[model samples]
Target chain A: MAAGGRWRQTLVGFLCLVLPLVSLWYHGRARPTPTLVERGLMRLTSPAQHAMSGVVASLSRVFTDYVWLVGVVEENRDIRRQNEVLAGLVQDREQLRKENRRLKELLRFKGERPELQTLAAQVIAKDVSPFHRVLKVALSAGADDGLERFQPVITPAGVVGHVERALGRYAEVKLAVDSDSRIATAAVGRDVKGTLVGSGDRGDFLATFETLGEAVAPGEEQRPLEAGDMLVTSGEDERYPKGLVVGHIGEGPARQSDLGWVYPVVPSVNFRTLDLVQIVTDHISTAPLDVPR
Target chain B: MSALGQSLSVILITFFLLGVESPLLQELHVSSFPPDLALVPVLWLALHVPPATGMVASLVIGLIKDGFVMGVPVGMYAEISVVTFLVARFLTSKVPIRGLSSLMITTMLLSVLASMLLALLSLLFDPAFQGHGTVLRLAGPVALVSAPFAPLVFFVLDRTDSLFARSRQRDAIFGR
Candidate 1:
């Protein structure tokens, strides 16, 4: 290589290494949006990336829905049995539902949760890196639609996560199963309350717990939390609504820690097939939420 | 092919791989850790291309990686990837790996190194990052899983590169 060429290469290499270091330091200082350089470069390439990811997701759907049917027969049988039982319950519930609606009409009740306004959104993209579990949601919304950043996002099944960033027509939701996610939660009927945290473990959504409220009594023999024990949002945490399902205790003995035994929580949202979610856009009052009787 | 052609080709390949890598791994039921296919292109460039070109390729690949995932700091992966590439370029220039076994070993070691660097960077950048320790614990396992994949990935990249090269070379031969 010529002297000038060698000089240019060395300078380029140095700049490449130094530039990222500078970026890391800058970002660590504060929360910021993409820099102009990053935005420009991303604009040039994002279309292609988006197209490829869409195609790949379609292919994955094929593999998941059709190619892998290992336990379909057993699953179908189990569902059929459950469906018969559910059918009976549905008939009984229909009678109760009619009576409840009639009573509500007499009382002039509008709805159970009129205070909490929400807009629906569908999952458009998922963060490809396992470490960063962010989902891109295509909102049926606009800036003036009462949607804002850091609002609680949920599905009918349970809590999906919270909106980390909200732009026009789209928002980024940080999953409840991500290591960075934290939610205030309590055991459904037990005195146990704790902060739910995701471990970001592979294969499943297994999160850890930190005891927060009243401690277990000293004298009595305490039963270790077991599998399928339910947890719900305590409403103590400002981020999510109180009483929303967070997760359930996982299939393992409660993990013992200095504070007490903390069990693994299996999040209620089926992240693998998470198709739609609702963002709780309207801010709630400071007064404790009253669950309808 | 010219320098720009090779560079553009590598960039596109990296982007596509980043998009599909996780889903493919999930389909394969390899949930323990994702095999680092991103490393393959950088490795190939390091081994085959000139140092300046390799460095540029690594930087571009790193930037793509930074853009590939959300919730991760933009420059974290970019810096780690560039550093990893520099190390690979330096080592290969010194010792010069020949066979698949050697390639596999180098890849495995580099994978571990990159993971450790990633953990360290995460710790520095994210105050709430609880997964750095977990990342450290899983580094060996991830490296072991990723090592065998290196040779196969390299083979595909090599075959693809040579296929185009052969077509170009045929024109030269016919003209000569």
Candidate 2:
């Protein structure tokens, strides 16, 4: 290379290394949070922001509830049909109850269930911009409702999202199905653990395993992640309670050559029509509902 | 009255326009189309006012845009502002006419360019940026939906300036 070109390359190399270090130094020295004055101002403004956020959240909840109300009516009909199928089984329910009670006793012997307090929150406003898929929810209750940040929000359909921003009356829910969002999840039936990521496309997700080298196929096959396979949170994230219905495996790449499963999932909640959700704020376990061993 | 006031007006106008385009008003369902009205002010300031004013206007508006933008981080707006300000400055000398046709063509090109640059910048920083499909899915429709409001914005801004100028001239004549 020419001497000038060599010098230019050297300068560029120096710049590439030096600029980031300078930026790092500058950023490291700078405070990440607002200044005292700014914080004071923010404190004053926060209530308004909270109120506006609440309004947006309530709007999302209203839409979600309206949609979910329709869904519940549909689901109630399905439940009525299933109830009839279960009706004949109800005669044998005493026998099944004994068996279920026995199984619950065994589970009770294993460990106590967490104490769970659920608050029904309504979807108020949704960031339905194709870019952002966040739903805000307002609780009929507030801090009095015992809602807190980092709580898991779910619908009867399944994991709807989680509590992001929380106020006395409302909170912002970042939905599970957001393509950019990830939640720690476990594959049901097979007990495989992985991180579930939203793929932006509806009814699809990508799960990367804690480790790889598991053979997989698409379709339900009495095993975890057998495509059509169901999965749920194992409380590994500690944000969500264990066993909340996440989604079913839509597809998993065959023969993982690495420490990960390329598993796709079908999310349970129809985010577009999601209305009412339950916030799992209290982890109540080993309650009287538990069948003692 | 002063150069600083002249520049401050441009910056304030740009800032106000940025807020106008924000989702805050979309929350109200006021205007059918929230114009990307920043361009009119930027174009006007760059052409009629000083280049320095235009540059500052771009930076203030860009910073506000970045700060308020939910999806992207800050500084991308600042970078775009600098680039757009420079580009507008360069193009001003090249383009002779400052008429409606020119403004329309300029707005179309600049809006498209800003969107493209934003996409490129976003892609460079974010891993999820490969989803150009998603950005286009959002920005393309938003730009198209919001484009028709640009001329209307310029019309109002022009009237405001003319009216203000008329008042100022009358004051001077009346020695008030």
Candidate 3:
């Protein structure tokens, strides 16, 4: 090729490559909507993402464990100061006590029938993804302790996620808030029931109700779901047990569709660096349609 | 100082500013975040190095990062690092990197550009990618992180430049 022609060819080649990228930029910038291609890309990149997640999880675990020493002192001082500052908190404690009692009753209700071994783990990480919110945790015991995959995980805050990947000493819990995680959840109050789907972003999940008359107010809290709401497994789907805390209702608008109520949930799992987590090893079910009472 | 020493100075200073300070600022959970550590290092390299050279450095660093902790595609960082290097190089030469305010402003602009580029690539290729907050959330953080660290990085680079006046070409190529 002539020098001029070669230069022209180079320019065209560059444009050919850059044009679609520009187009993609425009498309991505226009809206954060995912397309079929994007979904395929996510799946294709899952292994790499998973591996990176493990490295980060391990590193973060080490970082947090070491930091905990200094954190204990700061925490103690903060707690002591709060105790002195809010001494009158005891008067209001009565109402909190009653609420706590009711919550414990509910837990006992759910825990009584579970056939699997349960281990409680503390949250050590928060969601790292700016887009999809998934939580990972460190187990007090690993497979050596009989922890297995697909076990239902929970927190008093709510249904966090399940074990996505595991090793002999460590396992990764995929938070319910992950865009890929879907659960058949029901809004027990007002007889409004629907399928709760994770939206990846907190306050963005879809609670699709089939009933046409159901009403939801978007951005309004229908109820006082605390920062730590108990999420129990609803065995309706048979994938999980009868009452594992799935997630809590986060801040967002509840849409009242002619069909159902969709409430966006704020996941309770601290996804950044989960320190401790509980695994329910024996709760997987074969049936998919049984509704939980 | 030797050529290797100059290059080492640049990468070391950049790494310290980015890997350490960026996360610390994020932990502070401040409303307006500053420039990130990664962006700061990438920007510094782009300004001081040639495009081709910067591109190679970006690819190497990005691959190392993929091996390190990021939960994204393997080649994604390599691609982004090159683009960021080119953009910063273009902006620094065409605009100005002489004054602190100009440097800060340029760094801020470059950080935003890098963020937008990463965000775009992420949405396209990373299925599990959930955007942090809007650009608004990142801007404050970027400004906060990069502003204070800019002088420190510049000072180190300048000292290394004087120390290795003989091997200036290597320093230029390596962004030391």
Best by TM-score: 1
- Poorest lDDT segment (10 consecutive residues) of candidate 3 chain A: A204-213
Q: Score the docking of each candidate (DockQ).
A: 0.41, 0.10, 0.18
- Candidate 1 contains a number of clashing pairs equal to 0
Error of 2 at A6 (Å): 34
Estimate, for each residue in B67-141, the C-alpha lDDT of model 3 and write its tens digit. 222234445555656576677777877875766777677767766666676677776765555553443456556
lDDT tens readout by residue for model 1, B49-134: 67778788888888777765566666787887788888998888787777778888889888888888888988887665667877
What local lDDT score does residue A235 receive in model 3, on the 0 to 100 scale? Answer: 69
Model 1 iRMSD vs. native:
3.0
TM-score of chain B of 3: 0.72
Model 1 lDDT tens row, A1-293: 89999999899889889888788777555343445645554454444444554677678755654456444577596776576567647856985897576445423321444556677776766665556667767665353544565688887667888876555556668888888888987777677788898777656777877665255666544654567778888878777877778778887766556676677788888887776677888646442422221
Candidate 2 residue lDDT tens string, A1-293: 77986777466434433443333233223233323432232233333443655565467545543434344456487766566556546646775786576446434522433365677666554452334455556666433645565677876566777765555556666677666566776666564677676665522333333322343444433343566666677676667777767777765563343455566577876775555667877774323311111
TM-score of each: 0.76, 0.56, 0.57
List chain B TM-scores, each candidate.
Answer: 0.87, 0.72, 0.72
With a 3 Å backbone cut-off (N, CA, C), the pairs that clash in candidate 1 are: none
Candidate 3 has a DockQ of: 0.18
Residue-level lDDT of model 3, residues A156-218, one tens digit each, is 445656765444334456666655566655443333334556565444333222222334454
Worst lDDT run of 10 residues, candidate 3 chain B, spans B63-72
